[model samples]
Target: MPVQTRVVYQVNPSMVNALKTIREQAYNASRGVINQRVRIQTVDGQIYEGVVVNVDRRHVYLTVPAMQGYGRQWDEDLILTLVLYELLVITLLYI
Candidate 1:
């Protein structure tokens, strides 16, 4: 017998709207509900997946559970370059 493997791809933004909508409908919504799953590709074309824990109109903040090369959570100073997913939606913070 031979081993077999298959791969599946998902467009990360597909869930962004839903997450935003949920946040909008919640009474206790805070800046944190902006969290969403995003797919990021590095300069070398490697892919990574994690939560977009924060977002602004121009950029996204990712809490990546994994990092390549270092193979673990990176130090605070080194995290800036590893993720590159653009924010797909904008939500206002509760007043």
Candidate 2:
């Protein structure tokens, strides 16, 4: 059997924040989320999954289905806005 090793780097808080800010700016400028399905995990461990309807420098708006009874349906007026700093991971989903 092959041995496995893991290494971790302890980054300074300021550096981590700076990296995240830079990443956010790049992502916003690219508009990578627009029209693409994405699943986001927030810092609080909350998960949001849906298609991106709109995006801005500070927030990303997602078009998610509203649950009615046991079924899910689209609601044009309903939108979920998530702040950039709160996002821990955003995975783009391709169908």
Candidate 3:
């Protein structure tokens, strides 16, 4: 039997900086884009896809995608960076 290999994805630092800008602009613009779909790239190279639930000057709250056979779950991971509209926004949240 052949074993299947899972490829791990890594997020770039420059991308993180761009995402931060969108986040800030979104905050400043007070746009309804809040709670929008977001892909977060952690410093650990873990890629997380979730929704932006809440945001502040310090951190961003994302309701991580649901797990198998689990009640409503969520995680507050640091926003190292993001790619919104093809723009990369890197935040210090990862650090």
Candidate 4:
């Protein structure tokens, strides 16, 4: 058997800058809808409806209503942390 060699490639600077710009846009858009009810769809087709609580460089935090009757003593809302790049759609909810 012959020896195998591994090659490593560096990412292009232009592509990095483009991705950074896209991320910044996404963050700004998400920040605009903070504290508002919205529905978010991921690239994998999973959907989540919640209020936009906060956003960071790489993730958006949402506060979703938790289901009742699980024999818990305290009541609290569920917080979902989704990746920014994985989000496909974000729609404002009226109700």
Evaluated with lDDT, which candidate comes out highest?
4
Candidate 2 residue-wise lDDT at 10: 75
Please give each candidate's TM-score.
0.32, 0.62, 0.38, 0.72
RMSD of each: 13.0, 11.5, 13.1, 5.3
Give the C-alpha miss distance for residue 77 in model 3, angstroms.
14
lDDT of model 2, residue 35: 80
The TM-score-based order of candidates, best leading, equals 4, 2, 3, 1
Which scores better on lDDT, 3 or 4? 4
Model 3: how far residue 68 lies from native, Å: 3.3
Q: Across residues 26-68, which tens digit of lDDT does each residue of candidate 4 receive?
A: 7888999999999999889999999999999998999988765
Report residue 29 deviation for candidate 2 (angstroms): 7.9
lDDT of 3: 0.51
Clashing pairs in 2: none
What's model 3's TM-score? 0.38
How do the candidates rank by lDDT, highest first?
4, 2, 3, 1
Question: Candidate 3 lDDT, tens digit per residue, 15-71?
Answer: 988777765664553234355765556445656666666655545555654454346
Which candidate gets the maximum TM-score versus the true structure? 4
Q: Indicate the residue-level lDDT of 91 in model 2.
A: 86
Q: How many backbone clashes does candidate 3 have?
A: 11
